[model samples]
Target: MVERDRLIAALEDATHASSIHNSQPWRFRLVEGGVAVHLDPTVTPRTVDPVGRWALASIGAVVANLELALTSRTGRAVVTEITLGDSIPEAADLAGGAAYGEGPLAVITLGEAAETTTAMTAARLHGAIKERHTTRGPLLGGPPTEEEWAELQAAVAWAPGIQATPASEPLVRSLLSLTARAEDARQEDEDYLEEIQNWVENEAPSGTGIPRGAIGAPDAEGHVPIRDFTQTPMGSSGDGEAVFFEDPPALLVLHAASDTPVDQLRAGYAMQRAMLEATALGLGIGVLGQALEEPDSRAAVDGAAEESFGAPVVVHQILRLGHPAGTITYAATPRRPVTDLILD
Candidate 1:
């Protein structure tokens, strides 16, 4: 197989990467000389990511993983471009062609992998892409070392749309508080809660939605703070369990300059880069959007009006960094089959 083909095969293995409801809301198009990706509107999660921004971000992260795998395996890559749009479902003339539906997120021209053959390093990192899982189990230990924190910050440079800020103790605490508040706000509304409940109950056969086991045990208080994937009767149901993660030593919140779909995708791309880098350093990372998932929390975190900096923090994903208690196995989350996603 060619490099791109090999990379596509690697996607099958990079299953541990995060996606919206595990919808895998992306489609790949093989061109004569390059590849294209499209969002399958039908596959999107209505309740969790209504606007599809989160799903697009997740797809972008998948794209980043694929690039890393290709570079490691072939020592070179040439992306040229990444087009994004609600329409323009397939190929288009980028040079002209009405700029091809608003605009694309990016067009990465793959380059020769470092001649020094970081292949060993890249291979290990790439392998971790599949091994990495967002564990919600209680964190047993503290944050990574100062040196380790620096490494993760450096990894953020590789992400396209993310500006990662290390959270202070106050900031971290504030986010947790915000999370609790968001959970409360969500539960208070019957319509919203019911919608979330429906999503959790359905098990998408194609491996395109969140699996029941992926949620770990539920909250002992009878609530799933995140998406509440178990709200219905679709899978093997179970009771809640006590889980907690103490004040994480280090917290990184990924932000995008804009909230557009394309920008969201870039943010996702950045997330994967940071994630694999953290994995390579033997750090455990978890992505949480509780604070950014709801409007009130979003306003609190955005801080756009305060203008601490000229830019606002969109808070695409929140990553908690620390050491793992032990190896944790995740269920096989489904994905829409490649055949179902391919465009002629």
Candidate 2:
């Protein structure tokens, strides 16, 4: 039987994984063999993620953390089983065997921990869980070395049905432009604005949502625009004075073979692996989901993906990678305590 303390510790590590706006829309339950991850619809951003794509991805990230944590703790291989409910039920069920209500996003089973090269690699990535934070501040330093880039690519390649493509300079510019347009459109929508405002908190008692202090100062005009989580003016006014990127940082487009709930979950797993690998290599990473979250904008990116990869694929997320600019620090986003997240 899995030690109760170790299982709880792994669950805590799972909470540290990334989520949209730090919403952390997930719950966990201790099952017979391992843990079951469920989507907490109460915290899901319905306006932005009506289809639960981001929610599934978020759960996938949690699974990635759990696997790494359990493997490291017991020195065993972790196996994951995914179940898709009918029509992708909105809330977790949490009755009897179906811990997630309708159907679970994933049920991860732990194997006996063993001493192996793979386990050692997972241990290293597991160590990066706390160190890995989604960077919104300006990323500084040189681009990743070719070898480092290859490693990141390999990390994604390890997962089936997911592909990563490095964006060219022109494509990157197009993506930025598309993202800016999407952000502008979202800002104009009253419901979208209201929903976003509801999720951004200067100081959240629940320890979810984007913190004001974590908001980056606005960039000067002509630089890539980041989503303004603060709603209020937070970053530097683009006076066209400060220089941002000497060389464009690495931009990667993550795509799934098909656009299904299971595909999205797998994509999320691959994404977290890539991010953790990047963190282990001393690289900073940020995600731009504005375009992907918008229907028209997402279609544009899908077209781009088709052209870039010579096959039609669903673009799930965009990752910005580079070294950080000088010494950078920000308050960590708050997460719900394990007591609140555990169902049993």
Per-model TM against the reference:
0.80, 0.89
Candidate 1 C-alpha error for residue 171, in Å: 0.5
Model 2 bad stretches (over 4 Å)? 85-101, 202-205, 232-247
Please identify model 1 stretches exceeding 4 Å from their true place.
1-7, 11-16, 85-114, 117-121, 218-227, 232-238, 304-312
* Candidate 1 local lDDT, 247-305, one digit each (tens): 44367777766676556677788788788888787777766576676566778877732
Best candidate (score: TM-score): 2
> What lDDT is reached at residue 261 by model 2?
69
CA lDDT scores, all candidates in order: 0.61, 0.76
For each of the candidates, the C-alpha root-mean-square deviation to the true structure, in angstroms, is: 5.6, 4.1
Per-residue CA lDDT of model 2 for 231-274, tens digit only, reads 52333222333346434556888887677767777788889999
lDDT of 1 at 292: 70
